[model samples]
Target: MNDFFSTTILIATVASGIRLATPFLLASLGEALGQRSGVLNLGVDGVMLMGAFVAYFVVLKTGNPLIGAAAGILLGMVFGLVYAFITVNLHAEQGVSGIGIYLFGLGMSDLLFQKLVGTPLPIMPFPEIHIPLLADIPIIGPMLFTHSLIVYVAFLLVPAFTLLLNSTTYGMNIRAVGENPAAVDSLGVSVTKVRYSAIIIGNGLAGLAGAALAIELGIFQHNLTNSMGFIAIALVYFGAWRPFGVMAGSLIFGMVAAIVLQGKTLGIIPRSASDLAAMAPAVITIFALVLVANRFKQPAALSKPYERGR
Candidate 1:
């Protein structure tokens, strides 16, 4: 109890929480965009797995975190294209197709890892890029500015995503399509184009999220994301599909996770209860989702396919 209140402990906990939240934040932002455009991507976790493995492989071979990150984004775009084909072009059932993508990614990533790496090996992780003067501030500096470039990029995207969704012409088209594709279509906008773009952007973000997670941890293993993608989807609901809301939910989850992790190391939580302790973030997210369910409205055409005459 005493240690929990110590300044050092408090700062470390907050920093850890921010670090862990990066993947969730980036993934959720992407999911939000897709949902707003009337698409739901349930396969984000699978995409994340692929991204993680690819990023790890890139860094392992080239020793460049930026290249690894770029590769992750590219792979995400490829997966996004596949998903767009199934859900948008073929007009398949979104939920079922998404599950298929998830399974494919999960298995494929494992196979590639086993065939290529043979053993799980840790590499040099992303280096921390401290902000010059702000990082020197007593407590706030370390808590907010002492993370890798990915962390800042994730947070920065929050505002950018908000602007894209709320203040831009393209954002308006997305909202309109999600609400009433027929109307948007009649107005000269392309429903298929908007949804396709949204899905691609969302999945791409998931890939980037995975890369960030892998590089930060400096290792790749089977099931590296450990359902973080699923949690990211839930966060979309918890945030009522809004950018800031998603950011808030991700932060809550990250902080709780950081606390649980630290508690285990400090002997504050018993090893016997580790499983339940690990559930803290998911449980909290569910509760938050319930609270928001009554307050928010989902995109009207979410999970529903659109046809020219239908």
Candidate 2:
């Protein structure tokens, strides 16, 4: 116990926690955007799986994490288009279509791996970039400034999203659309266009989240994300559909996961309880969801397909 609280161990844990938060932050931010535009995409987990596999395969073949990340983003956007067509254009039930997309992604990713790779392989992950002066600070620097580019980008996005959602014309349209699409449409804004744009951006971010996770770990396996996409979706509710709130939620989950991993490494968590320990993050997520559900009111039009006339 004493060792776990040591300065070195604590710093390491916090740094690892920040790193672990990257994927959650990215995915949840995207989901928030979609929800803000009145779309509910429940297939985030499937999209993440597809992104992870594609990123892993690209990195394996090209040895460039950047290219792999790009590939992941592109694939995610493609999925986003399909999802938008079903839910936005075809007016299919968002929940059912989302599940179908998830199932397809899950099966397809695994099948691709079996046919193409046959075994898990390690790939070159993104290298850490230490901030010039900030990274030199004793504990603060290492914990906050030294991380892969994706980690920094994920954190930076909190502020970026906050600004975008609050200050931009399109952002206002999104909010209006989510709350009352008919009004926005009557005013000449195309509800379909706004929703489609939001979905694409949201799914693209989910893809990038998956790529970040795969590259951060430098390996990929079947179910590598372990339902992290679903967790990311929950984080949207936990965050009350806000970027800063989502960041807070991601950090909480990340820190808890890091603590659990650290405890295991220190043998503070007995081997007999390893499986139980692994459940800690999920347990935290459920409690958080319960606590926040009543406090936050979701968008009025969420999950309801908009037909201009009806």
Candidate 3:
């Protein structure tokens, strides 16, 4: 009986992990797109933080969660625009500029939170949407189908991203730019334009991830992601720049997190050990990177900005 119960708990934990990983999967997929287009936006953390704060506040003010989601998308687009200005237009170092954007977004989010909400009350959360038939399954039902709309959107994005990268004309252009910007430039395709678009789209996805963390999880605290943003970025590499691979990596990390948190609650693991378990995802990411570093080949112009001669 005890072993059976433990097995059930472990199965449930894995299911929950996939749900938790949805945000990471979505964020990393967006980053992969940008990286594949020759732009590396490190401001992903900041973008997500701002998106969370703004989306939560919007929901509170409007009494509509969908409005909050819209706010998240809009803020994400703005974050992308800022990244484009600093890196794409100014010919700045993509890595350094991304760090600057991260700092700016973090400070801005904190300032806005202090000014608007005064750090007193809690922000409202989004509602769940249960799938008709699928949500009725034994253990998998609630775990997969009964999440908020954003969760479903995240899962859908994996295949969508793969299809976009492998089957689209724009994706072809993006690949061309990443592999060899000079060749793309020679063909009259503006490398900067392609990179800028990727950055904007990637940052927008980061924002959505942030909003999901805050509104879906029902908290709007500072540094709410707890370095999940950085982990998402790392997962992109662990996934070897592929959307499906990123999804798999995110699911694994998410499950580890769920097990740690749930195990503490269930007394299967002590609270201290559970805290330690939170480090599992990061450790796994580092290990994966070490193992696959030699096999991975990033975009040729990932960190380079295109500068056309006058």
lDDT score for candidate 1 against the true structure: 0.92
As a whole number from 0 to 100, the lDDT of residue 31 in candidate 2 is 92
- For each of the candidates, the C-alpha root-mean-square deviation to the true structure, in angstroms, is 1.1, 1.2, 2.1
Pairs that clash in candidate 1: none
Better of 1 and 3 by TM-score: 1
- 1-39, model 1: which lDDT tens digit per residue? 788878899899999999889999999999899999888
Q: In model 1, which runs have C-alpha deviations exceeding 4 angstroms?
A: none
Number of clashing residue pairs, candidate 3: 0
| Model 1, position 44: C-alpha lDDT score | 93
**Number of backbone collisions per candidate:** 0, 0, 0
Clashing pairs in 2: none
Ranking by TM-score: 1, 2, 3
Which model is ahead, 1 or 3, in terms of lDDT? 1
